[model samples]
Target: MANSNGSKAAARDKRQRLTAAAAEVLHRQGVERTTIADIAQLADVPVGNVYYYFKTKDDLVRAALSAHADHLSLKLAHLDRDPDPRARLGALVASWVERRDITARYGCPTGTLAVELDKREPDGIDTEVGQLFRTLVDWVAEQFRRLGQPDPHDLAITFVAANQGMSLLSNALRDPTIMIREGERLRRWLDDLPT
Candidate 1:
């Protein structure tokens, strides 16, 4: 029983590590360019073992997307600890600024993946990938609602669009400073909103 339990724990850890590595590799290399061998190498697991955890590349990709969603949720939950909705929005911008360099290099993880997947044949993966933005927009809209905004959803869409645009430009120009500058402007915009 002890050995069985230990083996189960070890297997779970390896699966988690593989998924985490998949996310990083997919983020850096894009979905079409990444291979199972690359993910296994990054995870330090044998390539053959990857199949033990994931039956196909799409399955692994799904796992990676799920991981990204989980991370996003946790980050939003952490931001929600702030009582002020405006401040929460500011913090969201601040978090983006914090990741400016990476976003500049990788073009916003969710955005890049969504674009790549959307280009592929209709497999429902594109729609699944789109939920990431929906999650962000919904969360942002909730914050605006808390601030008594008349059109919370529209405002949320504008805010997210601005951020996504900033990310795209920063990545295209290879300039992290774009994110910082845009973040500052977003912060000011949030501050100017009616309480």
Candidate 2:
């Protein structure tokens, strides 16, 4: 049992290393140019080791997306305990930008991964990425529900779309200020929503 657990842990570590490599490739060269060899080199594992863990490049891509999304989920989960939905919305947006810069190292990995994979075939990790967006949408919808809105789901989608749109534009412009300004506006609008 101990050996089994140890093997699982080792495999998990290896997977993380590969995912980190994928992120490095995606960041330095853009996803289209980044290749399995690039990731294997970054991870310092034999090129064969990559295939040992991930079936294909798309698999690795999805895993990378899932890793980053999980990180975001961890950051967002605690907001559920916050009493004021308005305050929660503000904090969620603030944390999204702050964490994106800090953890992502390059930028919002979510956006980059989505753009890279959107043109390709769907796979395991794309669902995880889709769910990440759904998470934000649901969070916003929950806020709307708290605010007595009739359609929390649709409202949530708009809120998330606005947030993602802002982030995408901010990344393109290479301006954190855009995210801050637009994020603040979104939060204020949420706060002003009638309860």
Candidate 3:
């Protein structure tokens, strides 16, 4: 029984490691370029062991997306620290500003991944991949609604679109300054909102 329990624990650890490695590789190399071998090597697990955890690449991709969603949720949860909706919105913009270099280099993690999945799998995985953006949009929209915006949903979507645009341009141009400038503009826009 102890041996069986130990084996189960080892299996669980391997599965978690594979998911984490897949997320990193998928974000950096993208789904098209990433392979089971790449993820296995990165995770330090045997290539054949990958099959024991994820039946297919899509399965691994889904697991990676789940991990990414969990991570994003944790980061966004930081906004709850501030009671003011405007302050939370500003902080959201600021978070992006702080990652200007990363965004300029790799683009927005969720946005880029969603585009890649949408292009390749389209109807199959696009919806699941989009949940990352959807959750974010919902949270931002809630903040806008709390701030008494008449069109909170549209405003929230616009905010996400602006951030995505900043990430896209910054990554394309390889210029962190673009993201920083956009962050400033977003903050200014937030400040301009009526009380």
Winner by lDDT: 1
Error of 1 at 8 (Å): 0.7
| C-alpha positional error of residue 108 in candidate 3 after TM-score superposition, expressed in Å | 0.9
**Model 1 vs. true fold: TM:** 0.98
lDDT of 3 at 147: 97
* Per-model TM-score on C-alpha atoms: 0.98, 0.80, 0.94
Residue pairs with backbone overlap in model 1? none
Point out the higher-scoring one by TM-score: 1 or 3. Answer: 1
Query: Tens digits of per-residue lDDT for model 2 on 21-68?
Result: 786677556677888999988888889888999988877777677666
Collision count of model 3: 0
Off by over 4 Å in 3: 121-123
How do the residues 1-195 of candidate 3 rate in per-residue lDDT, one tens digit apiece?
999999999999999999999998898889899999999999999999899999999899999999989888997898888999999999999999898998898898889988888787365678987888899999999999999999999999999999999999999999999998999999999999997
Question: In model 3, what lDDT does residue 105 have?
Answer: 88
The better-scoring model by TM-score among 2 and 3 is 3
Give Cα-based local distance difference scores for all models: 0.94, 0.74, 0.92
Cα RMSD (angstroms) for every candidate in the order listed: 0.7, 3.1, 1.4
- TM-score winner between candidates 1 and 2: 1
- Displacement of residue 186 (Cα, Å) in model 2 is 1.3
lDDT of 1: 0.94
